[model samples]
Target: MDDHTALIRATLDHIHQGVCIFNKENRLVGWNQQVANMLSLKLTQFRVGADFDFLFRRLQDELRIQSGTSPASVLAWVEDRGPRPPLRFEVRQRQGRVFDIFAQEMPDRGFVISFTDVTAERRAAAALRAANDLLEARVEARTAEIAVALADAERANASKSRFVAAASHDLLQPLSAAKLYCASLADDTLAPAQTEILSKALNALNSVEDIIGALMDISQLETGNAPVRVGAVDLGRVLRQLGDELHPAARAKGLDLRIRPSHALVQTDASYLRRILQNLIGNAIRYTRTGRVLVGTRTDGDALRIEVWDTGPGIPLAEHENIYKEFHRIDPAANTGNGLGLGLAIVERACALLDHPHGMHTRLGRGTCFHLTVPRAGLPPRDAALPAPEPGTDLAGLIVLLVEADSQTRRALSGLMERWGVEVLDVASGTEAAALLAEIDLVPDAMLIDAPVDDGHAGLALIARLRAQFGQVPCRMLTADCTPGLGADCVLMDVSLLLEPVDPAALAFFLASARVSG
Candidate 1:
């Protein structure tokens, strides 16, 4: 062979795929040893002048023509010189091996064919498909398990909420009775030691009541059972009300509770906003041993920032996030009161539900300030202020119709009201109260009814009936059931709501207002 031909043959021999060329006369012109090896042909049989038809026939007979074309048709297809795209196909040998074949027509009517061994590649692709299938199956099974577990957890949470509702109501009944009795006893003359003992007893009862209230609030917030009625709320009025309600407690602690007044109306759920601020201020008061707790508001670019500041041992940086967690105390040893540490938890959840952004700023020992941002809803009405009953106001000659199912609570409340110079017509049920009122033919100046009198329906019905009968008597509904919609119901019925165990100062203020209105 000449040098050029020898060089071309040497280059073809180095190629990984089998390479072969055929002329227009269908005779082989060039080929590599790989062509002979891939086709299972002897070197003598694969001569340079060999006919392409003979090699194709041999391959067809040996490999069983897996492409589903007969040898005659394939030979005819190869003999044709029509212009077309490159033909690519796969063939499997009888020995279970696979090969990829490529045939490209040259410009001179001849063709170049290549054979590539794809047996390992096919096996690997099959293995990969199987592995992917197995992985997808495992993922599907795990997803199903997670869905079931989530459903179970949701059911358990709902059950716990129901239990909390029932247990709180049951517990608060006697707690209210005990507090009322202690309050009544405080009015009587006693020695200094006896009075101190009585005060401590009342403090302990108050602690229990606070813990229960916190738990109930947390449960309502977590279970999404706290109703949110968003509207334009009088910020000044709410602040003033809270200040009036909490002022006594702060004074008792010897802490100055300063509430800065503002007539800015805010767009928010009034009930939730009130509860959130109540918890913040109450928490501040609880932790603060000395100094002052201040509540105020400021305008902040279409939003109102309501802040509660306290002069107590501030939260540590490490415990900042933990403060919102249930039952997590900053300094457990220093906390002497019976608190479950649920105040901030409730506040957090309530704020989240209201979509109001809340946060805190703190110093280690000086103090801490908790703030919430709410959207501004313009100014309140010019005459938004009503004269609030003054502190230490008396309810003497105020006839209060008290309808409570629990006998002890009824008796204790009656005694406490009587001590305050109010005439109390206390009864165990709405039926008894109505019957007693009918028999005496006397209209009470106000009505204080337990919300759960006959599964929370009778008390509401009794209020409606009495208002229809007596013409617009001021009514207050007391309840330990912190269920959703209770406040809305009270509002719709135009009655005040007092959550138990009721604060004595708040109850006294209500009675004093009733006396004034009467």
Candidate 2:
């Protein structure tokens, strides 16, 4: 019997689960080393005759059950759930360990209990939950930050658009004044050298004007302000007009400039096509030192290829892509023009807006040719309506009432009109204009008014009042704003609107047209 008892103890000690047994008298009859270890008990303390309460008290202490709790209370709670059947539940200890506890009823009206550690599984699950919660918190924070950044970027873009518009309008006013004064200067007699000097100065001023105008165009394109108006465009007429306008510049440089007419009509925005060709041709004449600059067109399948050939130092293969970027210039010394290097950039944007495919072919030190494909109109070309010819010197006694708020613009325009033999009544305000009209005996032939005549104040009401007083006086409105609403307002007011910088010759032609209509 002693040897059998020794074998049973050895087998129980080797078992994975902690085991303990109680007799019918409720005294602990048997226990293994695993049971004592699990309950944090010494083998001597867990005597063979000790009561079941001793094991319960040991378990309660290890689990940190409230100090006021006694072994009898735990036993009573377990017993109140009814006679313990073969049941399983969990027990957790204060030392961060857990176990699955099982109870089995014995045939002799006693019970046996077992404990199995399950701490690793529970700890891993708890760690995963914590990590998931942290990830969700980070994602929410990042999304909120991106939303704020996007809103700030939108506001900054809006502010930049407004600033560009305002600055362009203001800058053109002084440029208009300068251009008018230059025209008046053209009528003065001077030495041959002086004449040449004056011509050079005018050219320089035109360059400055072009730079500002290009900047404005870029701003308009970026802000979606430039609306493309597509219609039947006569490539012949457009080519002819460009030839007439740009021939003198090319001739002055002793370069051969030729325009081959094409009667082909194309579907396009005439204005945008004109701008594209102008930039191409201007670059050709600007860069070429000695050779021909040819402008012509040909049919290629269903499209017309309008090409500009230049004898300038051709662009390299590497620079073909970069040349279209703003402020990118290959060689500044290749041309005498003080361009802002935005000509090709504008051409690129206009082509993109028109959906026209354009590209260039060049061979370094030889020559270059740039071309754009335009879809054929497939219809006859319409003759452009031409304005009446302005009198060369017969504008004498043409009474004109001018209202301009910019002093420089007023002075320059008034001087130019007087020089052209037109009687000018110029004023800086609507009130001064009213006083001038009261003093004059004869009614003026036409009224020329500048928009926003008083520093940032629109002249709409003043125009209405003048129209009411003059009774059907022919009025012309000059402004730098090309906004959509302004055009509608001009139409409703029954006034002719001219964009600035105002050309003296164009103004004369406009006045003649007004006279014929009136």
Model 2's alpha-carbon lDDT is: 0.76
- Give one digit per residue, the lDDT tens place, for model 1 in 1-518: 59999999999999889998988777899889997787788878877777887777667767755566556666766878686467777788877778888888888888888999998998899899999999999999999999999888778778887788888888888888888888888899999999999989988988888888888788777766456788777777677667656887887889999998888889987767878988999999989999999998887999999999999999989999999999988887887566988889988998899899999999989999999999999666474444656667777888899988788888888999999999989888778887999999999999998888226655678789888888899778888865545554554465667777777767887787677666
Steric clash pairs (candidate 1): none
lDDT of 1 at 423: 93
The prediction achieving the highest TM-score against the true structure is 1
Model 2 earns a TM-score of 0.59
Off by over 4 Å in 2: 1-150, 192-197, 219-278, 289-306, 349-356, 363-367, 373-407, 417-499, 503-518
Off by over 4 Å in 1: 1-7, 25-30, 41-79, 188-193, 219-229, 254-261, 288-292, 309-336, 359-369, 425-442, 453-472, 483-496
lDDT of 2 by residue, 242-297 (tens): 66446656877899988887878888887678778889999999899989999988
In lDDT terms, how accurate is model 1? 0.82
Each prediction's total of clashing residue pairs, residues at least 3 apart in sequence or on different chains, is: 0, 0
| Local distance difference test scores for all models | 0.82, 0.76
In terms of lDDT, the best-performing candidate is 1
